[model samples]
Target chain A: MIRLQNVSKIYKPNTGALSNVSLHIKAGEFVSIVGQSGSGKTTFAKLLFAEERPTKGEVIIGDWDISRIRQSEIPILRRQIGIVFQDYKLLPRKTVEENVAFALEVAGAGPSRIKKIVPQVLKIVGLSDKLGRYPRQLSGGEQQRVSIARSLVHTPKILVADEPTGNLDTIHSMEIIELLKRINEYGTTVVLVSHDRDIVNALKKRVITLHDGEIASDIERGKYMI
Target chain B: MSFFLSALRIIRFAFQNFFRNFWLSVITMSVFVLTLITVNALIFINVLGSATVQSVQEKVEVSIYFEPDTSDDIVKSAQGYLLGLSQVRNVTFVSAEDALVAFKEHHQNDAVILDSLEEIDGNPFGSALVISAWSPDDFTFILEAIETPEYQRYIKKKDFTDYEAVISKIQNLSDRIRIGGLVLAGFFILIAILIIFNTIRVATYVHRDEIGIMKLVGANDWFVRGPFLLEAIMYSAASTAIMVGIVFLSMRWLEPWVSTYFGGIDFSAQQFFLDNALLIFGSQFLVLSVLGLFTTMFAIRRYLRV
Candidate 1:
C-alpha cells in the first residue's frame, strides 16, 4: 500500500519538482508513472524510497509515514522497498554474486542464507551463469538484471523501477519490462517510472501521467497519453 | 552471530579496499613511517645530547691547592671536610710529593718548564684536594660550603672558575638542543597531519560513488563506515611495524659509529631504544592510529551523508 497526500517538493530559488501531488495505490498493484524529463516522475519515485523528502506533505507506505523519516530509519525503510535505477548502480569491482549478496549482507544475513539466496535471486534475473563476472564485464542488460536481482534479494514488498530501461535497447528494455511484470505476478507491488511511450502503452496497466509537477491523468489500462 | 558475521565481513572489506588501492595505501603508509622516523630521530638526538652533557659534567672537578707552608694535617682535614658534604661526589688528597711528580711528568715534553720547576727548592708545589660533585651546578654550592676561614687561609688557589664556564656552556647547549628538537618535532607532526588528512580525503573521494551506492542499498551507516575506519587502522599498524624495523636497523647500524664518536660518554642510542622499545613503538602506533582514524572520519563524513 502506498499513499502521497498533497506532497510538494520545491527546490531552492523557486524551482518545484513536484507540487500538490496526491495519489494512492493498494498492495500488489502494477502501476506505471510516465512524464517528460522534468515532469517530477523521478521525484515521485524518490519520495517512495525516502531519497527525497517532500517539502510539504505526507508519504505513507504500508502503515508508516516516511515524509519525514529519521536518518537512522532510512536504511530500515529501504531494505523493505526494492529500487532499481537507470544506471544499474552496481559496484564495478564486485562480481554479480557479490553484488546481490551485498544487499542481504548489509542486513546482517548469515553467510549460509546469503549463499542460498544470492544464487536463487540471480537465477530469477537470469544472471546465474555470470555470477563470477564483474559489472564491467557484463552487457547493459545483464548489468541491469544484476541490479534487479539485488533489489529482489530481500523479497521487498514494493518494487520501484526508476527508468530501469532508459539505457537499454528495445530488446533489453522489453526484457527488463517483462522481468518487472513477472516480479509483479509474484504479488509484490510494482511501481514503474519511465518516459518511454511504447513501454508505457505496452504495459496496459494503471497509468499515472504527470505534467509540470502535477498529475495529468490516472487511467486503468491507460495507454501512453502525454 | 549476525553481528560477528558483519564484523568479519567488515574486516574482509577493509583488506579488500586496502589492496584494491595498493599504491595509495603504500604512499599513505610511507608518510606515516617518515613521520614516525622523524619523531624517533628527535628522541635519539635529545637522549644523546643529555648524555654528552652528563659525560662532560662528570669529568669536571675543582682542585683546591694548599699554601706551600700548610701542614699535611691541615690539608688532610680540609679533604675530610670536603668529602663529608652531600654534594661532593669524591675527594682525592694529592700529597705535595705526588703533586711534584705529576707536574714533572706533565712538563716532561717541555725542557724550559721542567727547568723552571727544578729551580724551586725541595717542593714548590703544595698538597691539593681535588673534588668532584654530583652535578655541575652543585659544584658552586659545594665550593661555597667549604670556604671556611680555616680552609680559606691555607687555600692558595681555587681552580673552579674555568670549569664553571665550561659547565654553563654545556648546559646551555643541552637545553637548546632539547628545545630545538621539540620545535622541530612539532613542525613535522603538523606536516604529517596535513599530508595524512589530504591522503585520506583523496582516497575517500575515489570511493564516494561506492559509498553512495552502499547507502542506497540499505547498508547501515556504520556498515558503510566500518571498512574505511578499519582500513585506516590497518595502514597505521603496518606503517608502525615498518617504522619499528627501520628504527631498530638504523640504530644497529649507527651504534658503533656513535659509540666511537662519543667515546666513554656512556651513551648508546641502540641501548636506549632497546630499553624503551615498548613505550617508544607503542606510543608511535597509538598516535598514528589516532591520527589515521580521525582523518578518515573527517574525510569520509561528507560522502557518508548519502
Candidate 2:
C-alpha cells in the first residue's frame, strides 16, 4: 500500500521538481510511472525511498509517514522498499553472490541467513549459475538481474524499478520486465518508472502519466498514452 | 549481531578487499615502512646523540689551577675539602712535579714542545686540582665547593673562566635532543597521514562502484565507510609493527658501535636500553596506533562519505 497526497517537492528556491501531486496504489499492484524527462517520475520514486522528502504534504508507505522520517531511520525504510536503477549499480569488484551478500551484510543479516538467502535470490533472478561472475563478466541484462537479486535479499514489501530496462536491448528489456512481473506475483508491490513506450504498452498494467510535474492520466490496465 | 561479530566481519571484508588489490596494498604498506623507518632513524640518532652528550658532560671535570708558589700541603688541604663536597664525585691531586712529568710524557712525540719545556729552569706547570662531578647540573655546586677561603687564596690566573657557559651549552644540547625528538615524531606522523590519505583515495577510486552499490542497497553510512576505514587501519597497524621491528633491530646493531666510540658515558646505548626502551616502544605503539586510526578515519571520511 502506497499513498502520496498533494505531495510537492521543491529542490531549491524555485526548482519545483514535483508540485502538488497526489497518487495512490494498492498493495501488490504493479504500477508504471510514465513521463518525459524532467516530468517528476524520478522525483516521485526518490520520495518513496526518502532520498528526498516532499516539501509539502504526506507520503505514506504501508503505515510509515516517510516525509517525516529521521536520517537514522532511512536505512530501515530502504530495507522495506527495494530500489533498482538503470545503472545496475552492482559492485563491479564483487561477484554476483558477494554483491547480494553485501546487501544482507549491511542489513545485519547473520551469516547463516546470508548463506541461505543469497543463493535463493540469485536463483530467483536466474543468476544462480553465474554467482561467481563479476558485474563486468556478465551481460547488461545479467548485471541488472544481480541488482534485482540484491534488492530481493531483504524481501522488501515494495520494489521500485526506476528505468530498470533503460540500458537493455529489446529482448533483455523484456526479460527484465518479466523478472519484475514474477517478483510482483510473489506479492511484492512494484513501482516501475520508465519512458519506454513499447514496454509500457506491452505490460498493460496500471499506468500513471506525468506531464509538467502533474499527473496527466491514471488508467487501470493502461496502455502507453502520450 | 554482537559488536565483536560486527567488527570481525568488517575486518574480514577489509582483508579480503585488501588482497583484492594486493599490489596496491603492498605498495602502500611499503611506502609506510619506508617513511616510518626514516622517522625512527632520526629519533634514534637524536636520542643517541643526547645520551652521548649527557655522558660527556658527566665526565667534563673542572680543573682548578693553583697559584705558582702554593705549597703541596695547602693543595692537599684543598683536595680534602673538595672531596668532602657532595657535588664532587672525586678529586685527583696533580702536583707541579707530576704535572710537568705528565706533560713531558704527552709531548715526547713533539721534540719542539719537549725542548721548550726543558729550557725553563723550574717546573713551569702549576699543580692542578681536578673535580669530577656527578652530572652537568652538579657543576654549579662543585664551583662553590672550590671557592672556599682555604682554596680561594690558592686560585691562580688559569681557573676555568668558561665552565658555566660550557655546562649550560651541554644542558641546552640535551634540551634540544628532547625537543627534536618530538618534532621529528610529529613530522613523520604528518607524512604518514598524507601517504595513507592518498592510498585510500586510490582505493576509493578503484572501488567507487562498490560504494555506489552499497548506498543503493540501503547500506547506511557506517556500512559504506567501514571497509575503507578498516583497510587504512590495517595498513597503519602493520606499518607500525614493522617500524617498531626496524627500530629495535637498528638499536641492537648500533649498540656495539656506540659502546666502542663512547663507552665511558653513563647514558650509553646499554644504559638507555635499560632505562627507556620498553617505555619508548609502549608509547610509540600507543602514539602510532592513535595516529594511524585518526588518519585512516579522516581519509575515509573525506573520500568515502555516501
Candidate 3:
C-alpha cells in the first residue's frame, strides 16, 4: 500500500539524508526500518507522512502522490496516516481523554462520535484506566500509550512509528512492541523505524536496513544486522 | 450535527485551556479589559466635547444695541430688515426697562449693587435686539452685516468684542477636540495591539509543546488556531459587556445631578443616553472584536510555530 520510486532527500549540498531509495510495503504488513543514527530511516518516515517532501522522486501512500502535496492539504493527508514519535507529544494541560479527543476534534468529529470513539481507542492502547490522568501523572509508557491512542482516533490505514519505544525501558519497550503487533493484526499496515538491534531481531518481520543514505538490505523475515 | 458539535468541542477546549492557566488568563483578560475601558472613555470624552461645543453654539446670542437718538419706529423697521436675513434664526426686542429688570434679576444676590443701580430715576441703558444665529460661523457673518453703514443708521455701536472672542475660542476648542480625538484613538489602539500581541505570544510560548504535538498528530492549522481565536473573542466580548454596564449605570446614577448643575443646558441625561446608545455599544463591539481577532491571528502567524 506504499511505494517510493527513486526517493531522495538532501538537506543541503553535503548532507545527503536519503539517496535514490526505492521500497514498497504491501497492505497489513508490519515492516521495521532499521538503521543507525543519520541513516535516513527517520527521513523516510517523515516522507511517508508528508512532513518533508522527497527531493528527487515520488513518495506514494495509498494512491496519493504526497511528494507534491500542497501545504494546505497536509492535514488531510496526515489524517490517513497515524504517526508515533519517541517522546509522547501529549498536551500536558489536557487530561488523557482530552489528548485523545483532540485528534477527532481537529477532524471535526461529532461530540457523540468522539465520546464513543475516544474511550474505545484508549482501551485499545490499554490506557482505559488512566483516562482522567494528565501526561505528567502517568508513566512514560502510559504517556506513549496516550499518543498511540491519539493516532488511532482516525483508524488510519497506515501506522508509522518512529522509535516509539526509544524513551522506554526494556520491559516497556517489549510491551509497546506487543501493542503495535496487535494493532497490525487488526488489518492496518505498520511501519516502524528503529535503531534497536535486539528489538528488530526479536520480531523477525520484513526488515529494511539503511547505510549511508542507501538501503543496505531488504529481508522477508529479516534479522537486525549492523 | 457534527459541525456544531465540533465548534462546541473547540469552545470547550478553549474554555478549559483558559481556566487551566487561570492566573495567566486573568492577567491577560484584565489587561484587555483595562485597555478597552480607557479606549471607550477616550471616545466618550471626544463625543462629550463635541456635544458641549454644539450646546454652546446653540446658546450663543449676539446683541445689537440701538443709538440713543434712534426712534422705536426705526428700530422696529431695522428689526424687520434683520429678521429677513438668512443667518438670523431668532430676534427678541428688549426695551431698556426690560433689559434693566433682567440684569437686576441676574444680580439679585448683590442687594448693595442693586440698591446703587436703583438710584437712577430713568433707565440709562439703550434697548437692544438679541439676535441668535444658527451656528457660530453665522454669528460672525450676521454681526458683520449688522455693523454696515446702511444698517448703522438705525443701530448704534454694537460691542461684540467679548462675544466674538468667545465664539472664536469655541471654534478653536472644537477643532482641537477633533485632532485630540484622532491622536488619542491612534495612541491607545497602538498600545492595545502591543499588549494583545505580547500576551498572545506568551500564550503560544507556554503552549509550545502542545502546538508541536498537535501539529504532529495531524491537527490542521485551523484546528490549532481555533481555540486561541475563540479565547480572544471571549475576552473582548466579556470586557465590552462589563464596560458598557458600568457606563450605563454611571450615567443613570449621575443623571439628576448633572442636570442640576446646568439648569438652562436643557440636555436631559435620558436624551443623551438614547441618542448615543447604539453608537457607543456598536463602536465598542467593533473595536474590541477586531482588536481581539486580528491580534490573535497576527500572533499565531508570527510567534506560533510547530
Number of the top-ranking candidate, with DockQ as the measure: 1
After superposition, candidate 2 runs with Cα above 4 Å error:
B1-4, B27-31, B66-77, B83-86, B95-100, B109-127, B134-141, B153-158, B162-209, B248-285, B295-306
For candidate 1, lDDT tens digit of each residue in B1-306? 878998999998899888877897898788778878888888888888888888888898899999988999999998888888888999999999999999888888999888777687579988999998988889889888878988888889989997878989987887898888788878977887888788778878888999999999999888999999999899889988998889889989998998899999888788899899889898878877888788888888888776
lDDT of 3: 0.82
DockQ for every model comes to: 0.75, 0.56, 0.59
lDDT of 3 by residue, B1-306 (tens): 756866786788789988897887878777777776777678657766777787888888878888655666766767787799988888888877787899889999999878888797566677788888878788767877776676677676675676888889999999999998999899988898788777766766677677667777777777778888888777777777777777767667766776676445556554665687778666766777777778678767643343
- Models 1 onward score TM values of 0.93, 0.84, 0.83
Ranking by TM-score: 1, 2, 3
True contacts kept of each: 0.75, 0.59, 0.73
Model 3 alpha-carbon miss at residue A2, Å:
2.7
Instruction: For residues B224-264, write the lDDT of model 2, one tens digit per residue.
Output: 77767777767777877787677667778877887788766
Instruction: Assign candidate 1 its CAPRI class.
Output: medium
Model 3 has fnat of 0.73
For every model shown, the clashing-pair count is: 0, 0, 0
lDDT, candidates in the order shown:
0.90, 0.81, 0.82
Instruction: Give the per-residue lDDT digits (tens) of candidate 3, residues A91-204.
Output: 889999988988887777777889999999998988898888989999999998898889899998899999999999999999899989999999889999999988988997
